[model samples]
Target: MKQNLLGAIYLSLAASMWGGMYVISKYVLDFVPPLTLVWLRYIIAFVVLFAILKWLERKNENRAPIQKRDWFLLVWIGFIGYFASIALQFIGTKLSDAHTGSLITSATPAFIVFFARFLLKEKLTLRKICSVTLATIGVMTVIGWNINVGTYFWGSIILVGAAVTWALLSVYVKIASERFSSLTITTYAVLFALIFTTPFMLWELQSKDITYESSYVILGVLYLGIVSTAAAFFLWNKGLELMDAGIGSLFFFFQPLVGSFLGWLLLHEKLTFHFFIGGALILAGVLIVTLPTKSVENE
Candidate 1:
């Protein structure tokens, strides 16, 4: 129970960091193109995490070498997660409002739940079903009634693709947890992502003008790279290692909660009755997923 609580905290913190990232990214996006920013983020994260991982390996000489199968898994995860998923996320957010991005991507946990069942053989309980349903509705409500798919058609589709890829990444992360340390897995996965993103970054740079002189831009990039990408990803993987994937995913709902708050604070976005109502439902869903029933506890 205690471990579960700690895992929840870790995952929630990760989600919160990512939520805040949208605000920071929105500002940085003005200076950096989407793919370039993503490439830079992975590059920074790779360096930081790799240095730490190397240090740890040096300290612990008994650490086993990585297996070939794990390398394949890690590469696959990076390709789908960083190369495709995050890129899609950035594109979606670039095309849409931060609030809409957060709300639409809030459905990630629902996809994670289903993916966990298939990939990790996680149980599909009635409680989980109800929780996902309620949380999805909450996301819709928070996005408000003016959700015309035709308007932000491409953006919406991209966000949905992001959700799917991220879901797949989460499930695979759980699978990888069985073999490798989260630190090693995260570091190498990010390295692979950097490798994959380099060409795209180069292509993007050809057409986009970059301004690296601004201190604010540097700070924003650092925040996205170190805090959101590196630290949050480690925390998220740690949380998944400690808890069931489906249950742990409830913490992902925190993204919208924090995103909404940051949106209001940073963008001067207005909060409505729908926000509160939807937030309540989202919270309730999280509770239902996290707080096991009496029967489960007894078992």
Candidate 2:
């Protein structure tokens, strides 16, 4: 029970940070291109994570040596989840509209549930199904149904691919947690991601103009690298470590809810009736999965 509570807290915090990330990214992207910004974020995150990992080790929390299979798994997490999924998201959003990207990628939790069932052999309960349904509906309400499918067919497809890859990353992170500490997993996985993203960042630098003169851009990059990437990623991995992947996935609904709120707050975007309605439903869905149930206790 205590573990579940901690997991819930961690997941919620992680999702909330990511929700705020959209606002920060919007501000920072004005100066840095998407891929270049991502690369810098990873580099900063890797440094911070690696330092903490070393500090923990010195405090006698030494990690086990990773096996060859696990190394491959970590690389897969980095490549598919961090590099490929994020790249696809940027490209897809560029091609399509931001609304379509948000709407499509909101399906990530559903995909995570599916992958958890197959890969982790987790049982799919009625409660899980209901939670996902309600949350997905809430996301649709929040984002609206204004999809430009005819014009952005390929972008939509790529967004779907991004969703799938991220789901796979979540499930695999769960699998890896059996053998590794969340800190170790996150640190090493991010290292691999940084390596994979370097070439793309260099290529992007050639074509894109970067504004390094603005203090706002610098601060935004620092916030994204430290708060959103390092802390949020660790919290997410730790949360999944302590809970069922399917249940943890439901917490992802908080991202859109918080993002909408932050958009209104920071960006001065307008809030509508749909936002409140959708936020309530999303909260309810999370509670349905997160609260302890009699059946769950018995199991």
The top-ranked prediction according to TM-score is 2
State the lDDT at 115 in candidate 2.
98
Model 2 Cα lDDT, one tens digit per residue, 1-299: 89999999999999999999999998888889988899889999999999998988888744577888889999998898888889899989888989999999999999999999999999898889999999999999988878887889999999999999999999999999999889988999899999999998999889998988778889999999999999999999999999999999999989999999999998999999999888888888888878887776432
How accurate locally is residue 50 in candidate 1, as Cα lDDT from 0 to 100?
93
Clashes of each: 0, 0
Where model 1 places Cα greater than 4 Å from the true spot, the runs are: 92-103, 151-155, 297-299
Q: Score each candidate by Cα lDDT.
A: 0.86, 0.92
Query: What lDDT does model 1 reach?
Result: 0.86
Q: Which residue pairs show collisions in model 2? A: none
Per-residue error at 125 for model 1, in Å?
0.6
The list of candidate 2 runs beyond 4 A from truth reads 296-299
Per-candidate TM-score against the hidden true structure? 0.92, 0.97
